[model samples]
Target: MLKKIRWMAVVLLTGLVMYPLPLMADHQGAGQNSTLVLEPTVVTAGRIKEKKSDITTNVTIYTREDLEASSIQDLSDLMLKEGFMVREYPNSTISVAIRGFSTDTHGNDLSSSVLILVNGRRAGTGNLAKISMDNVERVEIIRGPASVQYGASALGGVINVITRKGKGPFTASLEGTLGSWDYKKGTVSMSGAVSQFDFDVTGSKSSQGDYDTGSGSEYRNTGFDSKERFSFNGGFTFLPQNRVGISYSDYSGDHIGSPDYLSANDPDDYVNHGIKSYDVYYDGQTRDDFLFWNIRYFKGKDEYETHDGAMTPSRTYWRDTDSQGAQAQITAKWAVAQITAGWDWVDYEVSNSNTVAGKENTYENPAGFFMVKTKLLEDKLVLTGGGRYDEYEVTSDTGKVKEDDNWSFSCGAVYKITGELSVRANYAQAFKMPTADQLFMLTDYSAWGMGIWSGNENLKPESSETYEAGIDYTRGSLTGSLTYFHTDFEDRIAYKSIGGGVTQYTNVQGGTLDGVEGSLQLDIGAMFGWDWEIVPYGSFTTFLEYEDDETNEKFQYTPEWSAAYGMRVNHVEYGLNARLNFTHYGRHEITDYEGTGATTLGPDTVADFSVGKELFDMNKFGKIRLKGEINNLFDRDYALVQGYPSPGRTFYLGLNYTY
Candidate 1:
């Protein structure tokens, strides 16, 4: 532990000492002034508009331009391309580890410690596969505990997806893509604004056939996946600084096949999943710009069913969940300070198709928060502090009920030393409550000849305290950042097996996790008169200590290092662009239940290349774009997790037309 602390101190000191050399360079390239800053305004950091350099926490933003420049087609593809620590397998659920914290294990609910939000609202489930890539405006990645802004499930970090809204005249677009493995996708979208109203709508469809791995071996039960999605949003303005809006989204997946692990026989495992959400909100600001308010109501449903082969009647099950929530927040601005107070409530009901009648479970959570931001030293230094409290209760049909309460707080500061550099530090305490399944589920099941399994009524919330420090530097066309973070956890939740095959959810003693993230961006075209850009980034995470050694066993699934670099070239005169990207993952050790060592799984490399061209332009009809992408350029055969090999080299071609 002492060695790790010393190492982090050295890295921080080195970055600070070398921050000023780049500021003295001449700015004479073509786009030096235009590209001086690489970050956009983000809201997830403080619930207000703030630049990346002004925030005390580490954040990464992906804009519309960033999405268009990559070959990614979904949330899974984007995470992998951005070099985030993630676990994904074909036809299986995907999970993301934020600073080495995630809720992944056998018999667990597959929920994540990292919270996922859409437009500042919790998105119910943790399944990343349900998110659609179409009609997205930006993505913000907050890389530290955010329990003050968000409540439970925020013990790690936050990922927020912001959707686009209409501003000017009506515009419509159509896009289609075709790739290997019989993969196909199409989307249509329209957006516009009238005298007192604005609207945006999008619809998409996608499907894929079975594929083979790089080893030239067919992976059975890798079956097919077909999905459809539709999203709509509209807003009406009644007066200045006042507007009301409504949004709806629906997604469905049909006959998604899962790989069979028990045997190599034909995969008969399949499932269908669906999600529907509706939201209505009002945004207004009082005169004199002293007060602002936002009130919202949301309702959502998620359902899924799984079944094996036709001959296996015993291996079938289905679950459905419904959720409703309401949020109200008001902010006041005074001299050199801003204060925000908010309250929210959520209710959930879970039902099973195979369970007995009247066996459903219900859960409810109510929370409130207060936050304040103060500016001092002539606006060169900023301080932020906030606290939140949440109370939850669960009820089941079998006359069983449980309740608990928790509170969290966060504080941070950012100081600007020079125009080209800034320093920031933060401390936060976060927590995650037990899910309804962990408290009310009761089923008789056997795994590998094990006995019955049932849920435990007594469980405690998992909590953590995080400390972070970082520095950001930007000069001419160079942008870079280095951040170090550490977290200490207590009463961590885990699924354990008692005697007589009675497995239940319990709390582990404690543990410590720490990591460092660094990034470097250089726009050669805007600095050295070159016609290209280069970006290199990397992150490292490890377990520092654990009260119970078995807790460290699960850390083996997390890789020690992940790195990526990409180079892009663009010719404005010719309307052409091309890029090459490479990503690498360090070997990860697999361990047993008792923290004993096992074989390693990863230590792989993959590459992707893409090119795009503008075919033609019309004054009123807009323009046409043609693109081609190749993934797995070297045909690398590897998997981030065992028993799942990635597909070999694949090709894709796409076209987009706007009017």
Candidate 2:
């Protein structure tokens, strides 16, 4: 896999130096500026809008234009191509980790240390399956502790999504996709503004049949997936400085198959899942724009049912989870200093039909935070400091309760050495509060045939201290950055298999991770006065020293080395775009499924490519475009986990029309 990827890189580089491309001008449509912005704007790092170059944390932003140029089918696709450290498991489960933390899937619990948010509010589950790329305006990712701004579960980082809002004149769009494995999908959306009211609405449905592996054989239990989704956002500006808005999102999946491990096919295992979420918010600003405030309330719920076996004696398991929260925040600025303060409350509950009656687990958390940012040395130097306090409680149906509290702090600084170069450094102390399931769940089931285990109510919250530094450069149409980060964890949680097929929860001494990430973008249209563009990005992560005094083994799932590099090319005049992506993961030493010895896996690389073109445009009828994408283009036979092979050589064709 490595050799293949290297050869492809050579070919790409060789072609770039020799190929001759035309110059194309950029267009941002009506009421939009054509000026090129090399650095994207971001909000996840500070809970406020700012240039990525101005933030002390390592941040990445993906704009709507970026999304439209990529072969993104879902959030996972976007992350994979962007070089984020995302883990993809069977049944399309997707999770992300920053600086080598929050990597655990926990069998789809979606309660990892990483946090996911939509419009500054927590999105339940953080399950990629529950996230759809519809009516999305932008995505910002912060790569490190964000507990000061986002509270618990942000120990690793945060993924903040911003949805589109109505502006300008009315517009409509339609999109459809057809692909290998009988895949089919369609989407429709509309956005417009009327007087003081604005609205955006979208809906989609999709389904796919079974897929074939690169070995020309079918993957068992990897049956089919079908889904439906709807989203709406509307706001009314009742006053010149105040606005009220409401948003709703719903997603449903039917008969999603859960394939067996190691190329094994199972015809009888599948699940049905659904999620519904709603948000109501108000935003107001005082005169002179010195003080800005926002208040919001949100609710989200998820349910799923799994079926095993084929005939009448089949068994079934089902679960329901609910999450709700509210927040109020104020930001005030004066001169070179800005202060932000906020308070929030969150609640989560989980229940299962297979568990004992009235055995539901519940968790409640309330938090407050204060942050300050200042500029010194004539705006060449920036400083940020923040702290948060979180109080949490866990309760079970049996009347048992546990209460705990923790405080987190962060400090960062950025220094500009020149007009085009800058350096940044940050330090943070973050903690992950124990989940209700971790503290109160008593249900036990066999894990990979290893043993039966139940949650431990006495477990303590996990904590970490992280340090990061980086350099950034932006000049004309060229932009590049490199960052290195390290993290040390304490009291990390783990589920251990004891004797006699019994497992128990325990605290590991902890672990340490260190890594580097880098990205580069060049606009050929401006560099050489051509109308083309190219962006090449890459990242590398590894554990410098893991394990503790009690164990010498490396942390599970911590690859010795992982790297991803990709390049995107575009010709604006011709409306042509193409992208090539490659990723490699080093070998991992993992405990065997049968509770025996360890096994070495991975050290694999995968590549993908996509191309798109505009077919035609009618003045009043809108513009139409065609796209083709191929995943696993090399047909490499590999697995993210032992016994689970990735799909191979799949193709997709799509059409999109916009007015």
Candidate 3:
């Protein structure tokens, strides 16, 4: 069986590396306004920089333009458009399910196993992986075990957010919106360079009333989310072969959570807590003809609070999270090969008040690791391999606990077939150590008497081995990628409540995921006075669970298939912008059939969208612009999660003026 599996992996890899092509074109992108496009671009793939084509892992990127056209209101709005991803928030919260591996289809859980970053810095949230886009430039999402690089949680991969930077002597833009459900939003940004030192700053605010479910209930979504943010990113070349840069960002926000099945009009609506965060980072690089060195340090803090009173059965919990870390690396490139070696360390501390216990408890975990990357075959064939050794030190407020050790590594290569096409393949072995709650939680009474449970010191970390292959093709006006990936997971850890508010997290053995994704874009030159951009995309995902009898079954919250189609048009001076998109999601199992949180068919989603725009040229020294958007344009009502039905027809109008 091992030999057969190995052979299949080799064949799949060969197919991608041997792509056929006659001609290819360049990809159109930003950064042309000023910054030189560096070779071997550094993308947030595994918290590491890599060439786009050389990336052998499963990943996705959403640029500023993509977000603008899609007009994503929040994380769910963004994930919904990425056909390869699955998102559901049964209780008006959101979670991510990538490549068929997911904890809950519901979005409310912050502990979804997906790690999130801002400007290469970590942010904190309890169960839900939440982020703000006040000054976001792009978001890169990588899937599969990332514990080797990002530390705890990242068992599912990582989401890295890159912020905006200055391009010229001075630049500024402002935006605001008014829409249904008493919605309103406003944003401002300014940036410029003085000498060789450049900087960018931004701030935004927004709010919305309850959206009527229009589902025969008085239920209205009562989410009023607002944020205030500021960030500065600057870098300067110090010596002939070195540069130093630094960034600092801060944010505070509050939002009223909408009840799952109730209308906003209810006087007894339960309010979910909101979050606040701050981050700081410093980076430096030194490169000579033969050797290179890079280093970075990051620190972040997150606090949570409720909008209404103190706490209750529904409030369930209260908490604070803080994370601090630093990493450094030294590498060299000789004629035959390029090599890299690095080290990283992080510390995480959480303080919480358990709902049932009503007693404050805390947990602290610290860890460290090392890794490397390389190449071979006269540079025509590239190969990379790295390993990480980390120790998890867990401590409780009451006493000391056990320690866990993990070793992880990845080996992959991409071969150039033609300048326009390339096929690549890689295999990785990784592991995820259990979280504090998974190993030390004490039973709590809640949720219709579901017995509460705690963690197990004797528990073992879950492990996985994944193999993937992909082909990338690019040509004038078009670019695309197709990938096939699979992972065999052992000892999946999950939190479960037996009944009566009591809960205990445990591990179940034997799981696997298989999926394929293909995305392509076509841009047409000026036609009918408009520049046209069209994209057709799709992804297929399925998870197999080895039941108690070791029989393969369906995993929860993972979709069988999903797809999307989009069209966009743009005109220069007149500033006419428009887009239309359609997305479809196949069936998914909500939870285990006989275990907890079970469901027959998790809700599927089919959405349609359209937006239009126009811009007014500068008026005297002031500029004015107008825009509009109509979502669920057809008034289609759907559910992104089981009980959490999405919004109905909604429209937005915006006006902005600048001096």
Candidate with maximal TM-score: 1
- Tens-place lDDT per residue, model 3, 495-606, is 6655555566777775777666666554544111123433333333333332222346676556665666667666555556677666666666664322435475533455
User: Candidate 1 local accuracy as lDDT?
Assistant: 0.76
- Cα misplacement distance, residue 351 of candidate 3 (Å): 1.7
lDDT of each: 0.76, 0.77, 0.59
Rank all candidate structures by their lDDT, best first, as comma-separated numbers: 2, 1, 3
Worst 10 residues of 2 by lDDT: 21-30
Clash counts for the predictions, in order: 0, 8, 34
Residue 168 CA error for candidate 3 (Å)? Answer: 1.9
**How do the candidates rank by TM-score, highest first?**
1, 2, 3
